[model samples]
Target: MACRRLGGVPWLFLILAWLPALCAAQTRAPYIPASPDVVLQQVPPTTDPRVRRFEQLRLDLQRHPHDAKRAVTLAQAYVDYARSTGDARFLGRAMAVIDPWMRRPLPPIPVALVHATVQQSRHFFKASRQELTTILAREPNNAQAWLTLATVAMVQGDMDEANRACVKLANTGGDFMGMICTASLRMLTGRAPQAYALLGLVEDPGPKAPPEIRAWIEGLMADTAMRLDRAALAEQHFKQALQWTPGDNFLLADYADFLLDEQRPRDVLALLQGDSASDTSFLRQVYAETALGLPQAKADAAAMAARFAAMDARGSHVFQREQAGFALHVQHDAPRALALAQQNWTVQRAPQDVRIYLEAALAADQPAAAQPALDFVQRTHLSDPSIDRLVARLRSDAMAQAAPRAKP
Candidate 1:
């Protein structure tokens, strides 16, 4: 699904109907910039069609030794895969691939790009800044680098920086990067029209775009549609994305959540593989565990536990996912879940995570938990039948509790 050249990597984005591009609201702490500029050189191979392909590049690296350029290419591929896939491990793998020669320099354009991406992925704002600036210092027109810089800025909640960087990159290509970034700022900043306009660039999925690229677009389209309150369209795009990337864990999780919202848990069990090892698979683990009467409940729970526990929540997607899991499993605290949902409800997961958590909290008789979520829904001006239903339930429950009763 991705084309990662020998030096530069590709990001893998799933079909978009899942949630906010920001993924999750991180709680740990601020992302620290790399203390020092980590310069990497050693260009990867510029030839070989197989080397140019992601699968081939990965295999080529595994088949050989310190091929710096190929390593970078392979690493970048992983980064791109991680980005589009919404999987942090792929990013970790990208970092791991470059860990050995990170002390050295001179890989290739693509390889260096991958490193810059890694910094961005880690939310190592400082490092991302340094690497990006340095890269642009050399290749000023490297639109991808500019996009990476902008994404890092966006994650930091630096709207100005994100705008500036995204604007610069916006014209770099008529491709997905420019359109997606421009639309991203628009959506997050409450410019649905602007965002939708940008999305319109990719009116239909391209046949030539690789699988990963296709998946990313699908996910993006779904996200935009959901924001516009197009549930059927969102589900449609999600299904398409899932079809394209069957092995994609992120897509699976998103789909599972969608299923949950649709009250179709019976389907979740078939898609998600439940096992102790599935722990690192965050969203999928959640899907497998939540679907009651799952064929292999115990195994699914174990997998969910292992995967969830092993996850590194630095990435926004992973962090938010883990938070949701905590609300679902550890806390069973609908209030906490509702809090987490509303925290990001404005961003994405519109009627799903936000509403589901709020509803669950109310259904669980946690009126306090439902309060903040209600305020959030009204403030955002989000009007959905589901939200209305849940709101009514919460209000009714609160009223019942408040009513005076005859002495029993």
Candidate 2:
């Protein structure tokens, strides 16, 4: 997904999906089944042409491992699978597939791009940015390279850099891809309504539109709708996107979060059933179970705690935001949660990052610690009712406490 943001059309040359945070659970020690029939993993058989093509590519790459073209193609496929499934194990595989070319001082352009993509997928933003910079310096009009660079900048909270990259993308003659990227930027920077309206044009690009494009647009629309507090519309868009890509872990996790906010934990349970292999999905499931007061919530929380411990042991900071959430919501350790959230906020400034930081600040009764999130909301004018409520309460509490202290 890092390599592909929104599907490119013609001149744009395939732009695809947003890169999601990788699940750190993939770093756990390998589990060996006592018997082959024990079924450690299960995927329903599929006759899907893409899956068949991927299988063929896998075989071809196996036979010709040194073929850079086949290797890049297969690695891209693996990255796509990692994004859709929320299973980062595929990302490691992708990196390994391209390792041969990575050793080169100047790998082939295609290999360089895919390598950058895998690095971005793994949250190595600086490395990915450097790789993309090198590629763009060599080929300025490369649409894919430009779009990927924009994604990296956006995720890193460098909106100006992202806009510059998007401008470069538009100059490369891919109006549609550039438009989508720009709309995404606007949605994140206080123009959700306008971005939502702009996306309507691509909402129904007829049957000719690729599933990936349609699904990506719908997901974006759904998020914008959520920001605007149009809950029903958001749910509809989320459902439509899921119909397009049923196994998309990003969609499932997002929709599940929406359901939880709507106080429909039962719906989350139904939505995320059998999809907790990834940390994101599993965390959502834990939230749902907590909401329902299910008996299994305790065990699940402990299991999740173990996973976070493993991640910390590996010195992996990519999942700090998620770990903060687990600490606050599941462990109810407000102080620790606030600490983690503050640390994560130093890395990225996404809306969710702000939300968790504010929530943890509130829970820990540390109103002053919430100043960064407060400043972000004021600067961005981000419109989210839930976040607004938290901000309002935090401000009120801070005022009340300050008043008492002043009187004393």
Candidate 3:
């Protein structure tokens, strides 16, 4: 299960990678086998086989420091562990272990594929593309490699490559979850209709699809629907997905997004009650933002503040969530909130965080704080209508307010 989570954590497929020289670097270092320390989480219950394999690899590597075979095997196990658990640090460790051997003389093709999965997590599109190219050159019929290439190509905004890869993989057999992947990608790229059509072919209504495949398809479908301005569809699909996979932290987060968008901030708070404190920054933001409309919002801020503080103190979570909080609370002597939010943003560049900080600065009357975010949004060219409309309204209203207080 850890391996499966690692295999599928959002955006993780973009980061880590393997190469031949990286392995060489490890080989020369104090005779130390690349046993990169793998941090793990026990939650969500990883499958026992994945856990057993991860432990076996760790022990094997402990014994044979120089055996590339064992090290590569161990790294793949770690990838599996990380995927199953949805924790990234294990994959990071896996990369450190495999780095010395990437590219200068690529690891075995399968091992290289594992390496590519890590790279994909980091959004290193170019490297990911290279990984697929190399793998396909060696074995064009490798379905997983092709699907991955398609996925990464979509990440890099290379829709044509993605389409080609998907077209090729569509014919390949096995529980290929290509529809989910392709449809979601298409939806994000502003082809919601195509996404929906592709989604129609997914095995969601069937009794035979495995839970993992079902969850993947359902989550993507819900998200695509939400982004395409189909909030009701999003809500329905999200609830259905949840029914199929209860206690999914990711699904809860999506629900929060939907609630906030629909102006039901209190619902967001209630829905996220069971989520881990660190995981609810965005939802917490919905609370903070919606608080202005509530008579007793300040009362809730304390708990939210505590949650942020605990997360800040915990130090394992990323910077984006923290940045969002700062953008929310900095207006009223909330320096700690601002700092924490900024801290998280600095550690990682999340577009959502950028949006929050932009809005926060605007609300706080800190134009300087907003400039960079403004630039980032413009550069990224995200045409989020709600945000654009809000910004436009703010400007228009500001201009109107400034025009005449003359008679009064």
| C-alpha TM-score for every candidate | 0.62, 0.87, 0.59
* Best candidate, TM-score: 2
Tens digits of per-residue lDDT for model 1 on 43-71? 22446332368667777888886787878
Query: Could you give candidate 3's per-residue lDDT for residues 1-408 as a string of tens digits?
Result: 001112333224232232344566787754444565753443423465666677777788879876778877888766655554345567777876665555345467776787787766544456667877999999888898988888766544455677788777876633345666667557645567788778867745488776656766777777667656788887888877777765555566667666766878767666665343333434454463455456445544555556556544533343345435534543354444445445544433343555455555555555454555455545544334455654564456556655867775
Q: Give the per-residue Cα lDDT of candidate 3 at 184.
A: 54
Which ten-residue region of model 1 has the weakest summed lDDT? 1-10
TM-score ranking of the models = 2, 1, 3
Clashes of 2: 7
Once fitted onto the true fold, the runs of candidate 1 whose alpha carbons sit more than 4 angstroms away are: 1-68, 80-93, 104-109, 122-130, 205-207, 273-299, 310-320, 329-331, 334-408
Q: TM-score of predicted model 2?
A: 0.87
How many backbone clashes does every candidate have?
Answer: 41, 7, 52
Provide C-alpha RMSD values for all models, in order.
11.9, 7.1, 9.5
Error (Å) of candidate 3 at residue 112 is 1.6
Task: Indicate the worst ten consecutive residues by lDDT in candidate 2.
Answer: 10-19
